[model samples]
Target: MRNDPLLSIKGLRVEFPTQDGPLVAVNNVDLDVARGEVLGIVGESGSGKTVLGLSAMGLIDRPGRLTAGQVVFDGQDVTKYSESGWRNIRGNRIAMIFQDPTTSLNPVQQIGAQMIEALQSHRDISRDNARQIIRNAMVRVGINSPDERLNAYPHQFSGGMRQRVVIAIALLNEPDLIIADEPTTALDVTIQAQILRDMRRLSRDTRTSLVWVTHDLGVVAQIAQRVAVMYAGRIVENGPTEKILKSPCHPYTEGLIASMPANALPGERLHSIPGGLPQLSKLPAGCSFAPRCNYAASACNMSPKLIQISSDHAVRCVSPLDGGS
Candidate 1:
């Protein structure tokens, strides 16, 4: 990872107004993505990983608001940008590949036309030039017969192929940062692996920073250089991927790793975390994971600040398993 981060998020908090109360989807969070680096944000559904990614892109729609924090990209705080300002940065300097290609692509539009529109929206390019750029992007994402595929509608392609098209569109601008929210979850394992490999190669070759948000740690292990584990809207652990996987410090992190199929003994049932995630609006005080944690104690009743356990590893737990004091 580069020393100078290309994207930085500090004290980010996203919330939705509710009749009962404000539902905090993303608690105070800090994150960074360096140029040419792939950072994975991993957690179960409703863990705020997706909300966090959307907040970074300035896409948290009304009803949902960025209550606090700064999303700084390339030295500019984007949280303060106007709609027009966001237009200049979003899709040009930063792009996002959302899950479900069916939703991302226009069913009525030809693949080539959609890609061309995306390219032209950000760059003043002619039809022929835009087509060429789109074609190249398609090829980069492992789409075959770029010319032929361009003329095809989204529904004409399979699930994996449609996702490839979405990825191609996101890469057409060659943005500095790409936030992918579980883009491959809909594909079969084989196709998912292929796309992951292609994405990693593309990021490395283009020097684009990538933030991959997903529930699958397996996906993260394959593509990310670093990992941030989220739970109940806050990051519980952050560190190098190898270290996080091999020696998770937070209880939630440990539970996630222990529950992975690879960690199970042959013929043994996969482990699972004991409790479902708490409601955002009704989250308990202190460590949110404490209620489900085996090591919970009196100190866990008070919120624990994220403390550095190692030079590069941090965990938000009063009694981090890594032995930090």
Candidate 2:
């Protein structure tokens, strides 16, 4: 992996303006993705993994604008750029694939049309050239009878096929960064594995950095070079995947590992973390994870910074090494 980061986010805060007050979905988040690296952001449903991914691409719009922080992409502060600057980078330099392809794909248009549009929108290639490129992309994604599938609508394809098309669209430009939000959630177990493998292999071959946003730790272990555990909108712990999964330091991280259905402990009782995520409208003052953190102490009441546990790892809570929830 490259020592210099491709994307860097610092003090990033995203809030939704409401009648009562502002609702903070993502708060005080800081992360970095290096070139040719896969950084997995793992968390429960409401922990803001999806929101954080969207914000990274400067995709937050309208009432849910970024409150504070800067997104440094290759040394440039993308957060400070006007609307046009973001337009230039999005889909061209950085591409994103969402969980539901149906939601992002056009139902009226054929698969070929959508992919061709994506190519032409970002590149100066002619329609004929773009069509050829799209076919090659379909073939690269393991699609058989690529020519026939090209004319089919989104509804005509299986869930896995649609996702592969979505991925192909994202890869059409060979972007430097790709952020996938639950890209495998809609597929079956077998199909999920295939897509995951294709994604990892393609990313490595192309030397593209990826941010895989998902609640699935198993997927993280399978494809990510590093993992960041998020809770209540903040990353509780982050480090190399092998190190963090093998020996988690944060309470939240520990619970997630113990509760993994894909790789549960042998002959050990499976334990789930108590309490659900807190309401965004009324967040806890200190560490947002305190209510569910078994290691909560008096110091936890005063918000803790991300403390370094080792050279490559950092945990948000004051005494994260004490453990468990």
Candidate 3:
């Protein structure tokens, strides 16, 4: 049986005010996270992956706002929620684990104190109960000697351990949705694998939906069952993980796949996508990717909306690749 998605984000446009004009950081996009699944948002830096994730959680900072579209969670349209309403939803029903755990965590406070506060912020629970929950969560995330660790400040833990603690904090409420932006970026490869595995197992055990935002295709590929490839504030392609990675249609998606070392031959010089990312303020009139696409044509000058390439795959390019080099 098909499971209804717990979150549906449609036409999500994010804009920031500039001296010249408004800048679209996250163009019109659509995304969904079922009751139990990890949706991967993959792209290079400045590709709108993190921006879109932030928009979903209604945490856009100053000068930036969710200008257009809807952020619907659990069958309700959250976009209309007042600031206080949104605040109530944040960190209780939906939480985010930002890229830099060090910065996301409070520096001066001990881990236990911050974690207890996070729990109490959402639930009307006692400090001792919150501490017990924190300990259980710490052990759940593989932290040893929960009591000793809880007393330690955020700076005391290694990068990996800190990240895990951040993950535990996010999971404290057993939220239906968790947005993890580059959670594994600071860790070594082995540690990255272990953390990703832990996230996968925990998601299954807890029935929480996850949106993993990262530039590492390898990490997303490892944990996400569905993939969304974004570039220049738009989603260029999205589909099942196997189909999108093995048979990417959009030129940008193809370029990202081609750049992966796994696809390169031994002793071969690495291939990078041609051309630099266009300035967001000076975005082109035609296809945003036309500057780098090798197969550009006059028809490509027209803006293209995401069109289905297969039963479950979609591409935004007028002329997508035909599964070949």
Q: Poorest 10 consecutive residues of model 3 by lDDT?
A: 316-325
| Candidate 3 positional error at 78, Å | 1.3
TM-score per candidate: 0.97, 0.94, 0.96
The digit string of per-residue lDDT tens for model 3 on 82-143 reads: 88988888888999998889999999999998898888888999988888888889888899
**Who wins the lDDT comparison?**
1
Please give the range of 10 consecutive residues that has the lowest summed lDDT in model 1: 316-325
For candidate 2, what is the lDDT?
Answer: 0.88
Provide the overall lDDT of each model, using Cα atoms, as 2-decimal numbers: 0.91, 0.88, 0.88
TM-score quality measure for candidate 1: 0.97
Which lDDT tens digits does candidate 1 get at residues 190-238? Answer: 9999999999899889888999999999999999999999999999999
Once fitted onto the true fold, the runs of candidate 2 whose alpha carbons sit more than 4 angstroms away are: 262-269, 322-325
- What order do you get sorting by lDDT, best first? 1, 2, 3
- Residue 55 lDDT (model 3): 81
List model 2 lDDT by residue over 209-294, tens digit each: 99999888888999999999998888889999998988888888888887776556687767878888898878889988889888
